[model samples]
Target: MTASNHPIVGILLLAAGKGTRFTAAGGEGNKLLALYPNSNGDQVPLLAFSLSQAVASGLPVRLVTRPDEMEIIAMAEQFGAAVTLVASSGSGETIAAGVCDSANWAGWLIAPADMGWLRSDDYVQVAAALSSDEAQARMMFDDMPGHPVGFGKGYGAALSQLTGDHGARQLLDDTKLVKLAGHSGVVKDADLPAQ
Candidate 1:
């Protein structure tokens, strides 16, 4: 059966963070809105690059962003993601909103929007692996945990009830994980310009 025949494992692209660390470190504005180099070395908005990767997964993508981020909203729409606006910029809040918005989906792959280094194929592979299993999963590159963690269908309520900045870390601790190795980009994020 094709992907459509299976229950959807939607991508919950989290983009509502305040990015205090980035800005405090001398990065401009919302880090997601800052221009960053893509794999091809072309400059594009950081969130746009991450959204591109998530959309390329061929899974349904629902992005949670701040209402003030019009540029990020436009980029998400352009990339074909269903957008949900949240007042709070907390990571947990963003995840909850996105997961609740996509509540009917069979599962969710929660991806941070600042991780511009990720490739489209990374999302694809993670979705594929998660679809074949019941356990939660995460990508590990060079033995380091990374973004776009996969939570199977069973964790919807726990995920929806999440709050604060701790975005799924506690819930993940309560469950077993299936770690898969992938490109080093999984461990890279745009928290700083040099990173």
Candidate 2:
């Protein structure tokens, strides 16, 4: 589809996961709720920071979160994102929920909520690349794959069928993925309090 003729490419922010690993690794409470210092000298919640960046990208955003996450739901709504609630705390479930919630979009840029360090420009750059390319694309940092993975409209069904905790790893391996050089923050995640 032509760039102008194509449907809107929205951002799917996955925030439903339990972040059990982070807590198991000694992190306190939910990792998404943990405060992280931003460049503005303010400590912001990880998920809130990530959602802000997604909103700043100038694209429609859909946030998948748990029903109990009132703070996250409020932050997402404040950012004007369409929120979808899921009972299971799984990446695949979150992805499916977000995709199903915004199924009318032309495509989606799936991003993990833990990657709070990614800037708005990063999302814009990846969206631009995905819009121009015929195949799916993903951010690559120092030869490693990164998040905000872009998928064309053709893969909507496959993305929606996702389940369990693997997210879209299988789709990435099965599709024609174009790798773009994303900033270092693409590879960064709030896995620990010190990070």
Model 1 C-alpha lDDT per residue in residues 1-195, reported as the tens digit of each score: 767666788888888888888988889778887887666998788887788778877889888988988988888889889999998657888888888888778888888888887777777767766754366888888888987798888889888988999999887743478788878889988778655
Which stretches of candidate 2 lie above 4 Å from their native place?
A: 1-6, 132-134, 173-175
lDDT of 1 at 115: 84
Q: What RMSD does model 2 have?
A: 2.8
Q: Report, for every candidate in turn, its global Cα lDDT versus the true structure.
A: 0.82, 0.83
TM-score per prediction, in order, is 0.91, 0.91
lDDT of 2 at 52: 85
Give per-residue CA lDDT, model 2, range 147-181, as digits (tens). Answer: 87988887889989899989888887434687889
| Model 2 error, position 10 (Å) | 0.5
- Cα-based lDDT at residue 144, candidate 2: 91
Candidate 1: residue 186 Cα off by (Å): 0.5
- Candidate 1 stretches with Cα past 4 Å from truth are 1-6, 131-134, 173-175
lDDT of 2 at 166: 94
